[model samples]
Target: MDAKSSATDAKPAAVDAKTAAAVAAAEAAGPSTGESVRIDSWIWSVRLVKTRSIGATACRGGHVRVNGERVKPAYAVRVGDEVRLRHEGRERVVVVKRLIRKRVGAPVAVQCYIDNSPPPPPRETVAAAGIRDRGTGRPTKRDRREMERLRGLGAGPGGPSGGGFAAQGRPGDRDPSGGRGRPNGR
Candidate 1:
């Protein structure tokens, strides 16, 4: 009885191992040839876009190109195509290395494409914008003036005419000429 029970257990274990191996092999092989995936689906699957819908939206918005030509979302993508996507103020250029139709982990997604994108532009060092330190009392009159001056809203050496919103005047301030028409009269 013990021998028979062990044989049964061994058979199931062997089958499980075989199944796992087959799945792994499929993943390693990637999508088979003759099976095409949509451009949007491919981009989303490979982590080029946040979501499949966003990929489609980018395609419709003319932000995605394949091999230097604009393509629609449903366009078929094959291996070895150059894909250029303009997204979020930068362009991502990649060559398709593998074809996948489902979103995968970051590690796996990266293997699907060879990134040829240019180095991103260096971030400009901008001064902190009006962030007051915590627990500081309200700005004094001088501090207020200084803040306004830094923001180009203060009266400069040339007074309010120094090219900024200050010269535009408050929305409620009426024209001194008592008319709202353009100076040259349309």
Candidate 2:
């Protein structure tokens, strides 16, 4: 055989060997039954949880469920299974689209599941309702009262009976004698 032809023949054999090795590796790492993967592994592999340990912890804490039933970390998860994970104060609902045992990049991870979470609340409506300006110092009595009123916790304009402090004598109105000392002879 000419030198060029011999080199070309060797290339095909090398490619075939690489392909066989890949196939063996995939089979060894894939699910034993080729139908389902462990829930914790799947969650971590798909990037639903930051780590496998966290995914397992969530499962143990009852923060993860499959098809409305709480499942253990080693529970088998098959395609089309609905997984609900409650983490970081939010619930993520996703349907398994594919089974993955190894962690993948964000793009591939996203493809393994279909997210069904609700849209987050708007920023304006969810901002801290009682946030105060920085370096403003403590709120004045007037400001505190206004905040209480806004929260419907303060007495009304009619005084304490009406839900306000007006009826109660102010510090200045109190007698120095410690008694209801009539300042002007009540």
Candidate 3:
């Protein structure tokens, strides 16, 4: 091998070892706040939604927490940790099964961790969620009547709520009916 190529390869190999050691040291530093994970990356990896940015927003909005304590994106999660969260209205609980460092599909994310999402909220809570009956098995006649009432009282053309109640776009889509929105706005 040429001397220049040999020297270049040798340098990178040493750098790799140094990087690995640094990582090990960092891991051993111990989280003063207890078991935690990167709020943004882990949420993305867990398929909780779709992207890191969304996860970060969730953390900021108080939707994600570690061991009952709200955490920021910098939190470092460890195994067997418990996390509390709220998506729409009802609270959820999740137990970390493993540490995931990379983004994964929804199915794979499910396999990576254990989520103890709270059972379906009471009928009243469901009604307050604004969204139509979710996983409510089958809508009974009474629910149908309430839905009709809600629709009639709504401001939207057919009875839909404001923009806040609308569905969110996925990670990389564009917003519709707007000049400015998120990438997943579509």
Error of 1 at 20 (Å): 13
Q: What is the C-alpha RMSD of each candidate to the true structure, in Å?
A: 10.3, 9.4, 20.2
Per-residue C-alpha lDDT of model 1 across residues 1-186, encoded as one tens digit per residue? 999999999998997786666545536555666878899999998898999999999999999999999999999999899999999888999999878777776756776789999998877755775678999989987787788878877775447546445656667877765665667443
Candidate with top lDDT is 1
Would you list the clashing residue pairs of candidate 1? none
Candidate 3 positional error at 72, Å: 0.9
User: Candidate 1 — worst ten consecutive residues by lDDT sum?
Assistant: 156-165
Candidate 3, run of 10 with poorest lDDT: 156-165
TM-score of 1: 0.61
Error of 2 at 53 (Å): 4.5
The Cα local distance difference test for each model comes to 0.83, 0.82, 0.67
Question: TM-score, each model?
Answer: 0.61, 0.59, 0.46
Question: What C-alpha lDDT, on a 0 to 100 scale, does residue 121 get in candidate 1?
Answer: 82
Output the better candidate (1/3) by lDDT. 1
lDDT of 3: 0.67
Better of 2 and 3 by TM-score: 2
Q: Tell me how far candidate 2 lies from the true structure as C-alpha RMSD in angstroms.
A: 9.4
Q: Compared with the true structure, what per-residue lDDT tens digits does model 3 show for residues 1-186?
A: 699999999998997786665444444542344445586777676777666887788899888988988888778888878878676666767887756666644544565568788686677744453466558776675675566557665454333543223454345665564536545445
